[model samples]
Target: MRSRSLVVPAVLAGLLAGSVADPASAHEQVSTPSAAVVGAAPASRVTAGWTLVARYGFDGGRPTPIADESGKGHTLRLVTRNGGTVSAVRHGIGHALRFPGKCLTGRRCPHAALQSPSAPNLNPGTRPISYGAKVLLSPSQTSKGQNVVQKGYSATSSQYKLQVDGAAGRASCVLVGARPGIKLITSTVSVADGTWHTVECRRTARALTVLVDGAVRGNRAIQPGLSVANDRPLSIGGKGAYSDNDQFQGTLDDVWVRVG
Candidate 1:
């Protein structure tokens, strides 16, 4: 209802030119570890083998109540400060949520973020996990480093976080826990050039890997003795545990998480 009057920009159209994808066909998993990446979600194609745990298909033209289409009701709330606005526009997949970069940009910067209630799947204990999202960032938008999606928000915090450092044009996926040390892998590939790209993180039993557009960009070996279970809610478009400090300045679509 709030999105009926929104106008899509021409440049955003260019950035989102692609065949629209249908929703993923995965149901509740069988619980025996069937795949390597996850389910058959259009967004999780590359990070194969894991099962679908949650999916925030923000295809809804509005930001609040981001629906989880994984058949599990892990719905996310569109949190805001002072009732700021978070807009949506046509993305390649359908509609994508946008966030403001900083404090004084007229858009919903740190004031608005998407959050889901804390769930067990989000706190994957000593298990492999994979998650991904389709994202876009304009050249002029300026947020030094923003998190695309995360379970933990701060330095030395929870399960994991996927970040896009706009200033560096790089992405990093990190898993933090005391049991096995931290697994940090970064991608040298740039994703801030106003184009649509898929960014993903895969944490297996023996290694952690970060991928950009289906290619492995960063990887590191680690033990499988970590427990990321915490009370923090899963968040997108901002750091969940950090009070939305690193609000993402761009658009996000087709977010999925699979806990192996």
Candidate 2:
């Protein structure tokens, strides 16, 4: 069993491995978590057989310790840069984190993301995996590709990403196997129309399927199926502070990931 993390607070000092601490923009101080407590995250009223890895409702307006509702101890850490601010607001069941989508200087939209302190056992190999989130995009998104949630962007890196195709295209879930075997499952309709939509992606042995708004929009077959790579930390909101990466310009809530 994984050593459960405690819900204390957010600390930005040594969050990233090798990132320099900038003094240019006075970013928001990370929330202070209580401490590293034992045991899994608080058990939910209902538990599923699929085994919930981590669920971030963002109910608390504060950042750190997004509170692993799954009682799995996989607490999420906040990573904000360049005047990025994350405020907790009401959305789905309780609250959601609102990503300003614009830079504090009102110039370049930096980025805000949530990362698990340690990589959970999300590498389901050939086993069944499911991820779902409720999203609401801002009226106008400046970037073309804004990532919503991603594990590993590349194939050799061994990961998967759930991101929007372009600024205005449908959301796509991608799973990369070894070279020559990749699955880019996308939604039929666009979900970036400034509305709340539930998007889910399921990865099975033979195929990768995406269901947007409870309808099957994309179902793609996996070539050389069952390849799990990378123990990289899972990221939400954007891949990294990059232009090509899709930095989700909206509010995200009810992010749930399960593996069997």
Candidate 3:
């Protein structure tokens, strides 16, 4: 599958990680899990299975996905970014899926909870994160939040993901403060809708790989150094900052974090 070009005007802004001291930071302070708890699995254990990390049902005015009417499937994927195009498929017609977007108040909505004391801040000057998809209808209401889960951070490391959103566009996922120190791996081709899209990020001592749906989409290498809290709460549906109101406006289901 090849990617299509979708004109997505950058709108929303990016969130900046902050420096704080608290319990959340304690857990996420170091590159690896602590040794205090013996026989305990490392932080990498979180992503062991297709864990249900965050889910949205699009109910309660929250930016979550509601259960499908037919209770069958609810997801879409894009396989390529060649022409900057993406596609979203609806399973069991009549059901709606929520995509993340800026709020009507010119602000990002609220979705996840932050555990860090000095969580990052969302800047309004940044571009809006774009997703490629055909809006079926103007949802009577939409969500204004996102779910964020952070694993232990290391100066040399990578991450993995199993994500499915409405469509595949130029800017589906946004990485803030991601420089030569930090790398993000994601899928290039969208997955078949109404099913699960498994993606992974492997940050070896050298480069990074973004697996789309199942195949690799992007690959690059760079020197790395990232400052992240070890005990920070792996937030879901929202950023770590309790102050910022930027939330993911979509539905998330089955999230898992583990060591590569």
The number of the candidate with the highest lDDT is: 1
Model 2: residues >4 Å from true position, as ranges? 1-48, 61-63, 102-108, 118-120, 241-245
Prediction 2 global C-alpha lDDT:
0.61
Cα deviation at 68, candidate 1, in Å, is: 0.7
lDDT of 2 by residue, 1-260 (tens): 12222232333535544322222132111222222222323222221578788777766533475667787877777665554556666554466667656433433655556776435466666677788788887546534455667676462366676776654556777776676544576566788787888887777667677777766666666754567656666778765433223457778888888886
* Order of the predicted models by TM-score, top scorer first: 2, 1, 3
What Cα-based lDDT does every candidate model obtain? Answer: 0.64, 0.61, 0.29
* Candidate 3 C-alpha lDDT tens digits along 1-260: 11222222121122223422222222111121111221212223222332232222222222222222122222211111111111122323222333343345432333233222211221111211111122222232233212223323323222221222333421122222333433333334444333334334433334444443333455554334422223333333343333342333443333333222
Stretches of model 1 off by over 4 angstroms after superposition: 1-49, 61-63, 102-110, 153-157, 179-181, 240-244
| lDDT-based ranking | 1, 2, 3
Model 1 agreement with the true structure over 60-128: per-residue lDDT tens digits: 533345568786778876555434446777765366767764466433434456677788767887888
lDDT of 2 at 136: 84
Model 3 collision count? 76
